[model samples]
Target: MKMKTRGNFQLQRVIGYFHGTIILFSIIIGAGIFLAPKGVLKYSSLNVGVSLSIWAACAVVSMVAALSHAELGTTFPRSGAQYYFLKRSLGPLISFSYIWVNLFASPAGTAARSLLLAGYIIHPFYPGCSVPEMPKKCLALAIVWCLGILNARGVKEVTWFQTLSTVVKMAVLCFISLTGIVLLVRGRKENLARFEKAFDAEVPDASQIAEAFLQGLYAYSGWGVLVRIAGELKNPGENIPKCVITALTLVALIYLLVNISYLAVLTPKEIMSSDAVAVTWMDKVIPSMQWAISIGVSSSIFSSLNCTVFSSSRVLYVASQEGQLPLILSTLNVHSCPVVAVLQMTILASFIIIPSDLILLVNYVGFIDWLQLGLMMTGLLKLRFQEPDLPRPYKNLWQLILVLLAGRLLRDTFLHYATVSLYVDPLKKILSNICIRNACVSRQFI
Candidate 1:
């Protein structure tokens, strides 16, 4: 028999294919597209060929993993993706660990990204806004709190907001893409680079290539959030797979084109040096359009923040229900939203914004997120074997290969974590290093 909660929280089946698609896109279109190109250009020049190839590589890997996830989501259309998959496949302990990591990582990462967007918005307005201060932190926290309140209102309301924001974001992106192409066509020599020079500029070695790929992958994370809401999907059997695959393809194409546009005007050195490469590109191509892109990027980040708060809080709510967290967090209001969970997540996210180096925060969040994603892939593969008889609406033939790729993704994530750990303050590093080392030792002892 199925279980029920005190709030009579029935599974939400209101979202349809379009909603699923937009939600998936919103999840993917965060601060990544704005910042990742600059990072990629730093390592591998603004060579359109090289940049597009890198994005293509990421798309292929992500698509393979998405295929496997589509099958798993179809098989078990539940709210807690890793939690449910791990419990059913491996055991309770593994699932619990996944949930624990998720509880700490998702909200913190989302909050960090939200603050990044807030920082970008404030940058144009504030003179030389480099340092983090109370005012900026407060503003970022206010964004988180406002989103939390909006989410608490209801999922339907939140979804509507997501849909509207997503539409506006897409429209602005399409305009930028179109205008950039036009500017390229009109002999905008200032933007175009000699193909030979662009390509011949310092070829990255294997390690550099690997680093670039990892950065690209981080930008491409979060397409899987759509899977997190599989249970609420109107038709999990068909929509889950379609939405994941379609949304990822669209995002990859947009990212590639946008980068091409940015490079059309800005040199690799120029892009790497500037924080707001998108704005720089816009200022060069269409100065009037700079504010539009800025607002669009800001809205993109805000929508992502809102969606993350909505989706991740549900994970916490489920954890609370399963006794992994305090029971109070599981409680829902009249709108069937996890009020306490939202508040708690918002508060923690607020604290993360205090330090406020957007790039650093994004990198840290990406590192941890990729780790979780690798684990999720492992859980998916395990579940496929253990629950062979479980009905899967969509099945991919290359499941094992995709699973291996997903496992291999850990290499980049680990490298990023190691790099960051090496650079962090020694005292803080000692404390975290102790915990990490002790955990490693304990595992070995066990």
Candidate 2:
């Protein structure tokens, strides 16, 4: 009874307007926001104003990139985000790299997130001692399969969890932000008063600022979530721009306020030293609610992990749909889920999750992610020029901002890895992303 395309089962447009917004919001508002401020502040020499400015700047850049992708999404409205754009705009060779890279990038990124979630959830049980890697990784793998099974079960189920998690994360963050704002109003400005001299200190060097920028961008990592699920939207052309504007505006506002909220109670030193910023903030203000927020953070990450699996499997599914991979991978079940694609992702994530180092995974995926963004921006330019009359319901010059952001990312990638030994980490991550089997990817792609 379902529609067929090119002998393949077709996907339905079950994702209505609000559900699409939740998908984007939940994915974008992942653990990065709760954890990234430390890296941003430390890298920026603990400059409060500079760190806050970086958060704002990152939001603007993410907005620009999101708007540009919204245009592209309106045009293509397909499964693959960067890959489809590359194949259409640039050519096959470059676009092919996207699939291979995502095969590794998606799982690696997912593993890191899962590990972070597990660490948070399990660490509290140990009280003062550290959690062993085995428990953390076992828990992380369990989460991957659990969420992957949900994904395998149905899109509707995945979206339900996604929506629930989004609401919880939003409510939790809003509560924290309001609590901090209220405290500041009552003249309890221990760390809040530091804002008056926020910009008083000397500026961090370009490299530091660049590092902080990378951290900020990580917080805004899921800005391109809409394009990955563009086809599922009720009316992509209208909904994508709407989702981008609505979801991203809320994410950016929440991120800034939450960072301020953290600062309101905890000092810059405590925040930088903290393994959990929100928990630390809660400890000072309302000690009893700390446990609840811990669970909330885990819930947020769990949903985020599911969303990552949901979006990433689509790329794998699209790969199969296009015949780049076996046809079975694209096959859907009774629930219209790409069960094969979801399972393969879970298997791969399980294997590599053993070596899950959050920072390493972040750096690895960050470079490749931004690199793809660069190519997507390049492709956007080509599409604009070659098909001037393309039916684009939404249009913007945000492509240029994407291009600049990509350039800045590349600059920092090189600057941060000046030494050969240090540089090899990025190289390893790239290799890890593109190389899975005995076959090795070409070096030129880097």
- Among these predictions, the greatest TM-score belongs to 2
TM-score of each: 0.89, 0.92
Query: Judged by lDDT, which candidate is best?
Result: 2
lDDT of 2: 0.79
Per-residue lDDT tens digits of candidate 2, residues 1-446?
A: 24234455677888877998888888888889877888888888888899899999999988887888777778888876556778778886676677777877888888888888888888667754667889988998888889877887788888888878887887888899898788778875475587878887668988778777777888888767778877777888898889888988999999998988887787779887776778777878887777778888898888888888888878788877776667778877777777788888899889878875566567667777788888888888888899999888888887876788788778867655545424566755565444643223342432
1-446: candidate 1 lDDT, tens digit per residue: 13246756755778888888888889788778887786666555455567667878988877776776676667777775656666667776666666656655777677677666776676665533352565567778788888888988887998899888998889877877777687678775566654434566667765556556666876787767766767678878889888887898898888777776776677777777776766767767767666777788888888887878878877777666676567888777877777888888888787666565555555566656666666666666666677678777787666566546545655645665566655665654675576556545543422
Show model 2 residue runs off by greater than 4 Å: 1-8, 418-446
Q: Which ten residues in a row have the lowest lDDT in candidate 1?
A: 437-446
